[model samples]
Target: MKSIGSKWMVVLFVAVGVFMLFNGRAQAAYPEKPITLMVPFEAGGGVDGFARALASRMEKDLGVPVVVSNEKGSGGRRGSIALFKSAPDGYTIGFPHIATLIYDDTLGETKSPVDYSKYAVILRVDTATFFMYVDKKQPFKSVKDMKSAGQALKFASTGIGTPSWLIPSAVGSAAGFRTSFVSGHKNLAEAALAVARGDVVGGTGSYTHFRGVIDDVRPLVYMSDKKSYHLPDVPTIADLGFGKLSTLGVPWVIVGPPGTPEDKLEKLRGVLRKIIQQDEFKKWGLENGYEPDIMPPDVFWKKMGELKEVYLGLKPQMQEKK
Candidate 1:
C-alpha cells in the first residue's frame, strides 16, 4: 500500500509541474488567440464606438484580431458582471465603467451584480464631461426655464446606475425642480434619441450622439468643474451654484477579470501605453468626444478609490427623492 501511494504522489506532482510550465508559457505568449473586448452596451452607443476604435488600434499593435462583443443590459452591469466573472485569461479583457459601477455598487440603494473593485484595472482609457441635452421643440430653452416650469419633466437614461440618471437626478434636486428618469434605454445613444423624438424632455451624457441631430437637441447644462471647449458659452453645474453636486464626468476604463496573470497584464499594459502615446490615437479620441486621459494602473485605481469617496459624500443627495 505504501509503494502504491508513493507512485501515485510522484505522478500527481509531475502532472502539476507540467501544468504550471505550460501556464507560464501561455501567459508569456499572451494573445495566442483573438482577444475579446466586451463592451457592455449596444453597438452604436458611445462605449461601443470607443471600444471598436480601441480594438482596431490594439489589433494593429498586438498582431491579432481584437473583436468587440456587445454585452448590453443593466445600464452596463450585466455585461460588466459577465466580464468580471469570466476566466482571468488575457483574451477575455473588457472595458468596465468602473467609476459609475462604484456609484451603483456602493451608494446606490439597489446593489448591482458587479463588485466594482473586483476587476483588474488596466488603465483609465477616456473621460468626458457630462452634458444635459434637450430637444429643441421642448418649451424650455435653458435650465432656468425648466426649473420654473412647475411640472416634473421626464428624462431618459441608459440605466439607473449611469451618469445619465445620477446627473439629472442630482441637478434637478439641487436646482429646485421636479424631474423623473425614464430608464432602460441600454445606452446613451438610445437615451439621446428618446430626447430627440420627444419621448423624454432630456438626457445627460458625455457623448450626446448628436451627429445629424445637433440642431434638433440643444444642450442645457454642462456638468463639469469647467465649461467644455466646444460649448464654451454653456454653464457648468458649479457655475449654476450646485457646488455640492460636483462630479467628475464619466470615465471608461479597460480592465481584466480578477486574478488575471500578472505577466499577461503587464504585457497588455505595455502595448496600451504605446498606443496611448500615438498622435493618431490621441487625435481620434479628441475628435470622438473621448478625452484621452492616460494613467498607470496604480494611479488609475487610486483615482477610482477617490471617486468612490466623493460619491459616498453625495449619498444623502443620491438617496433623496427626485
Candidate 2:
C-alpha cells in the first residue's frame, strides 16, 4: 500500500511539471496568430508597397502571417484611428505619417478618437523630403521658370491638411507666390497623375510618388538642404532661397495601438531591426526611393516630437490657406 501511494504521488508531480512547461511556452509565444498591418493609403502606391514588403519580411522572423490592410481615407486618418482604437493584443499595427496623424487632431477640424500622442511607435522605416513636380507639357522649364511664370498655379494635393498641400503652401508663403490648391486627390500617385495628365499645373509629394512619372513630369525643386541623389540636377528649395522650410521631411513610422505589451513591442523592434539590415530590404528601399534608415522607438519618438512642434508652428499658416 505504501509503494502504491508513492507511485501515485510521483505521477501527480510529473503531470504538474508537464503543465508548467507548456504554460511557459504558451506565455512566451507572442504572436500566436496572424498579425494585421494597416496602411492608411490606397493599394499599389508607395506606402502600400512598403507595407507589403515589410510584412513579407516580418512574417519570416515572427513565424506568423503578416497581412496588409488598406484603410484609405482622410490622408491616413482613417487607418490611424482604427489602429489606435484596436484591441491592445499586439495584433493590429499601423503605418502612418506623424503629420497626418496629428493634422485633424491638432486643428480640431473633427473629433478624433486617437491623438498622435497615443501611438506607440515601434520603428521608423524611412523619410522623404517634399518635392514639387510640374507637368512636362507646361511651359515652365525649371524652378526658375516656374517662379518667373508669376501666375497663380494649381497644385494637386491629397487633401486640406496633407503634407502634399502644406509643404507647397508653406513654400508659397516663404517664397512669395500664390498657390491655388486642387485638393481631394486620393493618393500621391493620383496627385502626380493629375500633374502628368495636365489636370493640375503641378503637384507636391515625396519622390517615391513622383519617381514613376519622372519622365512625364519635371521635378523642379525638392525641399531639402542638399540636392537629392535621384534628382541630382534639380535644385533644392533652400538653394532656391526658401531655406527655412528645407528641414522638413516626412518620416514613415510603424505604430502599435496604445497599451501594447512591452515584450511584444520589443519583439517587433528586434524583427524590424533585422529586416532593415538585410541587403534585400536595402536594395528594395533604394529602388523604391525609400531611405533605408531604421530609427528605433526612443529616437523615433524624439524626432516625432520635434517634427510635431515644427508643424504646430506651421499649422496656423496652413489653416489660413483653407
Least accurate 10 contiguous residues by lDDT in model 2: 102-111
Instruction: Assess every candidate by TM-score.
Output: 0.85, 0.88
Tell me the tens digit of each residue's lDDT in model 1 across 261-319. 78778878888878877899888877777667677888877767777777777678778
Determine the backbone clash count of candidate 2.
Answer: 0
Off by over 4 Å in 1: 1-27, 243-248
> Global lDDT of each model?
0.78, 0.81
Runs of candidate 2 exceeding 4 Å displacement: 1-23, 141-150, 241-244
Candidate 1: residue 14 lDDT (0-100): 100
Error of model 2, residue 318, in angstroms:
2.4
CA lDDT for candidate 1: 0.78
| Candidate 2 per-residue C-alpha lDDT over 265-300 given as tens digits, one digit per residue, 9 for 90 to 100 | 888989999999999889988888876788887887
RMSD of 1: 5.0
